[model samples]
Target: MDLDAYVVAHAHEWARLEELVRAGRRTGPESDELVDRYQQVATHLSVIRTAAPDGEVVAYLSSLLNRARMAMLGARVLSWRAAGRFFTHQFPAALYRLRYWWLGCMAANIVVSAVLMWWFVDHPEVEQTLLSKQEVDDLVNNDFESYYSEHAASAFATRVWINNAWVAALCMALGITGVGVVWLLFQNVLNVAVVGSIMTRHDRADLFWGLILPHGLLELTAVFVAGGVGLKLFWSWIEPGGISRGNSLAIAGRTMVTVALGLVAVLFVSGIIEAFVTPSPLPTWARIAIGILAEIAFFAYVFVLGRQAVRAGHTGDISADLLEDRVATQD
Candidate 1:
């Protein structure tokens, strides 16, 4: 319990551990010695925290152990094999597990958009109330169709990707509150319905579907996925089942972060479709077919590879070994 005496007694081992960590590369014997000293120092740090409660000594040991850990494990941080597992296993598994949430979100949003679009078309007065005649005329005659082709394809694609990724990230980031995700998705639904009804009313239905379907399918699906995952995150702590709420929230938060990383690539693909394929000179059917294929491929990724990964015990979390930094104290 005497912090000064304890420091003097164990300072030699801490010094040895530091020496091993600083020794460029390790021989087998030195590596063994480093491992032993690392464990001893960790024990000392814990005892100091619980028994002596010395801030300065604890801070020093914590930093030393952190460096020791990186020295031991840093070489394996970047590996193609790890990346491969992440995409094929971790990402897909998370998708599979969260499929119900996202799938339901996708379905509900589609229905809401369709129904709202129909309502808007049925009640043309609502459009007039919202937009003046000049605005409506401009949107229908030009803006609706020209929007996709207005910008250079690559720049447009990047912009769309960044925008969509931001929305998805917002969903995951604010998922704990539950309201932000719903508000975001609702805003998206409102925008789509308003625009689609305008096109339909102005007798530009073909042009609208032709331009939108090619990219909208996949892009909207990605949005729905994010919304669903966000809602699921909110539910994790609320209905934690048998687990402690903190543990449930922690697990869901980790999973949300993992899924967010995967969604960047998803949003990028959708953005590419939106920018290039949507405005391309290809037949509308052909462009829409590409979008359908992409959407199908995403679903397949979730249901097929994702399911297999889940069966094999992947939960989209970072590997167990890396979570060693988490320490539990007495409850």
Candidate 2:
């Protein structure tokens, strides 16, 4: 009850606790001892609160307790272990869990592009209606191919990365609207159809495929992934599956974050292929081969490692430690 006397009596114990905390890592006995010391210090603080409530002692013990809590919990943010697990487990698991959504988006886009391409090819004069003769000639003979080579390789690659990353980000961002994602995809496929039809009609089909395939495969897949993930965000609220709509939407939004981050890297790789491989002096087959390999690697990453991570109980959502507390809500 005498504050000064109490301090003198427990000063050695307090010093010992501080020593164990600053020791960095501990042996088995030391860990047990640390826990014991922590409990005693907490009790000491409690007694002070009730009996003396000394300001300086309370503050010191509070700060010590905060550090001790983090150390015991092993909380990490900017660590190699966290970053590595994010990519290998969390990212892939998210991709695998929602594989069908993106796969369907990819398939639907391909079919729409093919159908529109065929229609445009069948009606070659339709392009002539939109563009003047000179414009068509310039696009077929110069514009499409020259676009890739006009900028320096590194500059082009960076520009392409930023542009493609933006598109993927937009897809996910607009997913909440539901219709926004569909409209974006439609516009994307429509552009592809128009261009493919123009090239095929002008007897430049080979040129189109050579320039596009080297980057388009993986590039387009990333777009579909973003679009699909975005749609998942929308669907969560519409059908929350026994949970409150707010809770479901929050979970989906968090899960989509993993896709958003992973897609940035994916888009960067495709941009490099587009800027360098697409326009390089390498044989068309080799360039296309590189693109194919990248696309396969992405899918394999999703279906293989992602699948395993999901089965191992790794959700694409942020780790529990990183999540904020939520309030209950009605469905």
Per-residue alpha-carbon lDDT of candidate 1 for residues 142-255, written as tens digits (9 for 90 to 100) = 988888999999999999999999988887777789998888898999998998999898899999899888888888888888888899999999999899999898888888
Ten consecutive residues with minimal summed lDDT in candidate 2? 322-331
Could you give me the TM-score of model 1 versus the true structure? Answer: 0.84
The per-model lDDT (C-alpha) reads 0.87, 0.88
Q: Model 2: per-residue lDDT, tens digit, 101-122?
A: 9999999999999999999889
Q: How far does residue 126 in candidate 1 sit from its true spot (Å)?
A: 0.7
lDDT of 1 at 137: 94
Clash count, predicted structure 2: 0
Could you tell me which residue pairs clash in candidate 2?
none
